[model samples]
Target: MNFSLVREMMRKDLQEVRKNGYVFYSLLLLPIMLVVISVIDSFAIALSSSGKASMLLPTFSTILVFIPAIITSLIGSTSVILEKNNHSLEPLLATPITDSELFAGKALAPLSIGILLSWLAFTLYMAIMDVLTYGHLGYFLFPTELTLVQMFFLAPVTGMLGTFLTLLVSSKMKDVRAAQQVSALVVLPLLLLIFLPIIASGSDLLINLLAGVGFLIAALAIFFVSVKAFRRETILISWGK
Candidate 1:
């Protein structure tokens, strides 16, 4: 892969995303809103019952983990569809860049943003949980090993899964709305994780390790399938259909 080409494509895509007011603002706002909601929920849980508040952290983290994946799917699908609409995709495909490089470049911007925002949201959540429960718990109550693994490992993998799925769907579908609608389904697995914390009984370490490894494998499988399925010709021919 030509790193230079991938970097250039990523830079160009980032510039375009920044220039689009709606996309840029939504990307900025969604993470903040998610963090705020998480904080409020944490506070509510603390007030309701401090003991249960700690017990619910795993479930809360599981739900919080999906925010970045959701953001990436929305932005990634919109990015590809917008490129097709703007007449930019064909010219980009005509260049010397390989399909892998193109896919990497296209995936990087949203993936990076999603991962970064996911970490930031978690960081804010940890801070809020620590502050709000300090009086009751008398110490920092977050960034448990499980939470750390969820933020750094599971969250990024889930974001990548969402990104690739969105790109694949965007490449196949002509309508941005339809592509986004289908792409939204990619987060279902992550959403399902929320239920695990309810019924799961084990050391936090074991549960997180199992969940992280499972998600990592799923992400790798999706990445390979996406790379194999993505075709510049298919995208070009399918345009405006």
Candidate 2:
């Protein structure tokens, strides 16, 4: 319940994750993968098609959104489920921390890492693309900066939302394998967004704006539900053996 306690918990959890060699390695590796994939796709498309570089740029950039989704959903969900499986939740709940504080601490580490990595990956991707195309790179790479801005701003919000939702679901599901499957399903719509042919052809400003609005609305709804219904009592009732 205490703000200071929540902050300390978050800092410690994140520090522990950092100390884990595999977690550290994966954190470093994921952003580089995003950059590599973006560069490869950008160059391949530039070479293979008659389309102007301007048109293809947005498509390449859109892939950055997936970086956070995959990180949060895959990496974040597994960690949360593991904690529950290991019987760590009971002690965490015994603390003076409120459910929200506990959830916030649990959620912040992965959301922060995932979103930061996603932004870094996108930034690196844009830098590479700019250098290849214009021989110079600056703060802004694209003509209307909305997509770049949206990617930086909204991608992380989505990542946090996705991670928290999965954690909540895992707390209720109890079965780690089933929780992982449900978490994977959470990403299916996002994968569809990435692979959907229409988005790939070129960025649609109208659709992007609408999607952003929809995300905001969905986030607000989830916050209400998380705050109102997410409690130790509720979790125990739903998932306790």
Candidate number achieving the greatest TM-score relative to the actual structure: 1
Error of 2 at 232 (Å): 1.8
Task: Give the poorly placed runs of model 2, Cα more than 4 Å off.
Answer: 49-51, 135-144, 190-201, 234-241
- Per-residue lDDT tens digits of candidate 1, residues 25-89? 87888778887876787688678876877777555665566766787787788776677788988
For each of the candidates, the C-alpha root-mean-square deviation to the true structure, in angstroms, is: 2.6, 3.3
lDDT, candidate 2, 11-74, per-residue tens? 8777878898987887779789878987888877766663465666667676676666667766
Residue 149 C-alpha lDDT in model 1? 77
What TM-score fits each model?
A: 0.88, 0.82
- Evaluated at residue 215, the lDDT of candidate 2 is 64
